[model samples]
Target: MDFNFTEEQDMVRDGLSRMVREQYGPEERRQLIASDAGWSKAIWGQLAELGILGMSFSEEDGGFGGGAIDSMVIMEEFGKGLVVEPFVPTVVCAGGFLKHAGTAAQKEEHIGGIVSGERVFAFAYAEPRGRYDLANIETTAKKDGGDYVLNGHKAVVIGAPWASHLVVTARTGGERTDAQGISVFVVDKSADGIVTRDYATVDGRRASEVYFENVRVPADALIGEEGNALPLIERVTDEAIAAQCAEACGAMKVAHAMTLDYAKQRKQFGVPIASFQVLQHRMVDMYTEYECSVSMTYLATLRLDADERTRKEAVSAAKVRVAQAAHHVGQEAIQIHGGNGMTDEYAIGHYFKRLTIFDSEFGNIDHHMKRHIALAS
Candidate 1:
């Protein structure tokens, strides 16, 4: 399938690139990172004004009616800018969860606000075990009259510190990983029994450890049917993986460009490094890996609505290839810059750090490799 951006998508990319260059240059990003929120409200508002935050939602939902490919474009630009905003957690993952499984009332109440940037939301799926395996959840939600009482801890909940709400995954059924008792609920972060400990992540983002002690929500808060959210959760995870792969592709592109510029300007052995045949070959390899990532990401995005096995295979393939590409591109970019690459004074260092964090987030190369092998077998 063709992976070239359409005219409209190109316009979207160009607009974002221009905005980031004009408003969120390296210095601005640095200041935002050091701030308490670890992001810029001004930039977030600007993105909303541009309708980028709502571009992927349907028009009836107060969005531009763009699809997965539109989301991929936005994520790619965000990655290139090293945007510290919770765009993925709030807009992509949380919004996707609601769009796919939320009731009509739930969509009317929450999705428009999310699309308009009036509120932020996060997905609370990870637990203390630090695994992306949805079946490994230990959090429980027991029925209490017309409400469900939630009790457990969620670790590394991204954007939770700023989120007004969270889509939480809890055990409501059997004990096995593939048990049918899994369910999802919409929980207010300010609920009486909820406690949050917030911290800064390595990539200058905010994450929180949230504890729920008998937090209760009406049964209507449950997304979709009771004890049937696992399949939806799996689909959301695959979409997240696809989105991350696209971001990795963008990061690799930026890193490659930065390295190329550095090689042409930085001198070694009384000559520019770009003149060296060995260094040139390394840059070529980086370009090749980036192309592979871009191709795989597009494939996964196009096949998002396919059957579970096919979707898993495509997403896992993209994630594995992108994870490997991100690692190689990050290291090569750093190496090309020599000692300066490791310093905070340089933008390349920050890009490398973000790429490292992205590689481990969602699911890493090893995780996707195992998943791919299992699916193939």
Candidate 2:
């Protein structure tokens, strides 16, 4: 199979690369992170104008009809820049759910805002006790006269503080861990009885702990058939896992390159460290891990449209491999940079922080390993 990108995809990648290189230097990134919103609205608008935000959805949904590969390209570039934008939460997670499970009218109502960057979105699914289980939801949405009243707490909702809308999961029927009786609902972030406590994440992004105390939403707020959203949730979560792995691959590439550059410049014992054979071997190991990660990410991207079992297995495998690479590449990058790598002023440390966070998002290495084993056996 040809892993080569199409001309359009290449253009997209090049365009984003140029945007980040020219507009998002380390100091500029710091300023953006320190800003009240914790991200750059100008850059967000630029992405919308460039059509990057719409690249992952279908034309009927007012997008470019691009799929997993499109998201892979955009996210990898974003990773290289340490972009603090909510693209993953807004476009990948929430938009993926909308595209896969939303009704035509629902798609028409919300997708344009995402494509135009006029509205930010977030997926509020992770509960305080969920621990990577999609079905482990304690949030409940009880029917109440043409509406549903939601009540529960969502933990670490990335981008929620800035999001105008949220796609939330709630239990409508059975127990917390049951596959059935789960549903997805879209709620306005400013709705009555909704509360959020926002904070800056370690990786320079913003997330919030949101609470719903009898939050009421109209009947039209439901995304798909009630009590049957787990499959859609699972499929979209796998896509998110694949997208994040690709992002890690991009970060790993940058980390490896930066470490090599540092080795060439920093002298030790009156000689450049790159000249040391032992250090060279370590850099080589980092490069090998990066290469393997990229290959696995590509494989997972291609398998997104495969059968459910195959897709899940491929995604899990890629997540596990990429998680390992994140650790190895990040640590080696830090080691090569010495104590300077630990400081917030340097870019290397930020990359390492992002990689560390990437290890836990969606699923960690051990989590994916267990998932792959369960599916295979």
Candidate 3:
């Protein structure tokens, strides 16, 4: 399949890139990182005004009726700018989840606010072990009279500190890793019996550890049918992984460009370092890795709605390639920047850190490699 972007998609990317460059340059990013929210609400509003925040949702939900590829385009631009906003968690993960699995009433109630950037949402799936395994949830939600009582903890819920709501996965029955009886709930952050310990993540993102001690929610809060959320969760996770791979690819491209410019300008011994054969070879390798990542990301995006086996294989392959590419490109960019690369004063250092965090999130290279191999066998 041809992976070329349509004219409209290209325009969307270009417009976003221009906006980010003008509105969220390196200094602006630094200031946002130092802020309490680790992001700018004004920028978020601007994105909403541009219709980018609602780009991937249906028109009935106040969105633009875009798809997975549309999300990938927006996320790539966000990654290029090192945006601290919770676009992926709110727009891609939560919005996609609701669009796919939520009842019509649920979509009408929640998605409009999310698409308008008036309400933020997060996915609380990881537990103390911090694995992305959907079935490893120890959080329990027991059925009560007209409600479900949730009791347990969620670890490292990204954007939870700023989220108005969360999509939490809890075990309704069976063992911790059993797929059976897994359920998803929509929980309000301000509800009684809920506690949150907020913190700044390594990449200047806001996250929190949330506790639900008998937190009660109505039966309608459960997304889709109870005990049948596994398939939906798996599908959303695959799309999330593909979106992240696209972001990583975009970040790697930016890092490569920044390092190339540095090499060309930072002259040493009466000549630009970029003129050196060894440095040229290193740059070539970085470019090659980035190309591979782009190819894999595009392939995975196209397969977002494919058959189960095909989707799984494509996403796993993309995640593995993107992880490797991000690592190689980050390291090479840092190397090219020399001692200055390790300093916080330089944007390259921050870019490298973000790349590292991205590789680790969703699923790392090793995790995807194992999945890919298992599927192959």
Candidate 4:
């Protein structure tokens, strides 16, 4: 099959690339990260104006009718910039849920806002005790008359500080960790009984430990069926895995390039280190790892619309490969750069930190490996 991007996709990629380059230089990025909001709303609005936020939704849903590939394209570019915008949470995760299972009213109310970038969303799924398991939810949503009272803590909620809304997962029927009882809802972040303690993440992004204390949401907030949301969650998260795998690929590509540049410049024994075959070999390995990761990301992206088993296998395989590649590429880059790579002033260090965090998001190498093995068995 042909791997070439369509003209529109190319335009999208080029447009986003220019945006990142023009907007997020190293110094600019630091300022944005150090700001009180930890991200740039101006850039967010620019993305909306560029139609990127609406790229994945259907025209009927007020989007550009793009799909997994569009997200892959956008995220890879975001990775290159170390963008802290919540695209994955707002567009990929929340929009995926609305696209796949949301009621008509839900879509009408949310998708337009999402496409316009007026309603920012963070996915509140990872509980304190949940370690990469989508079903391992301890957050509870007890049903009351025409509403649900939520009570739980969502840990490491990326982009929660900037989100106007949250796509949250909670148990509404069965016991904890039970697959059948897990449900998803779209909650207002400013709702009463909801509290957030925000912090800057190591990757220069902002995140929050979100607490829900008897937070009441109308029944209309529920996204899918009352007690059958695990499959929906799995499918959306697999899509997220694929998107992030693409992101890792972008970071790895940049990291490898930085290492190559550094090796060519930094003199050792009165000669550039790039001339050393041992160091050259290590850089070559990093490039190889990056190319392989891009291939795996493509595999996962293409398989998103496949059958559940096939999609899971492909996503798991990509996540495992991408995670390992991110780790190797990052560590090798650091070692090659010596002390310069360890400092906060260097761009390489920031890239390394993002790659390190990428491994843990959605699933790590071992987590995907085990998931792939279980599916194969």
What lDDT does each candidate get? 0.87, 0.92, 0.88, 0.93
**Which sections of candidate 4 miss by over 4 Å?**
none
For each candidate, give its TM-score against the true structure.
Answer: 0.97, 0.99, 0.98, 0.99
| Tens-digit lDDT string for candidate 1 (323-352) | 888889999999989999999889989889
lDDT of candidate 4?
0.93
lDDT, residue 12, model 1: 85
Per-residue C-alpha lDDT of model 3 across residues 1-377, encoded as one tens digit per residue: 66678888898999999999998888888888898778888888888888888889878777887899999998888889888888888988899789988899999988888878898998998898747677887899999999999999998889999899999999999888888999998888899999999999888789999999999999999998897788888888888888888788878889999999999999999999999999999999999999998888889999989998889999999988888888899999999999999998899998898888887776777888888898888
> By lDDT, is 1 or 4 better?
4
Flag regions of model 1 displaced more than 4 Å.
Answer: none
TM-score of 2: 0.99
Please identify which of the two predictions, 3 or 4, would achieve the higher TM-score against the true structure: 4
Which 10-residue window of candidate 4 scores lowest in summed lDDT? 172-181
State the weakest 10-residue window (summed lDDT) of model 2.
Answer: 359-368
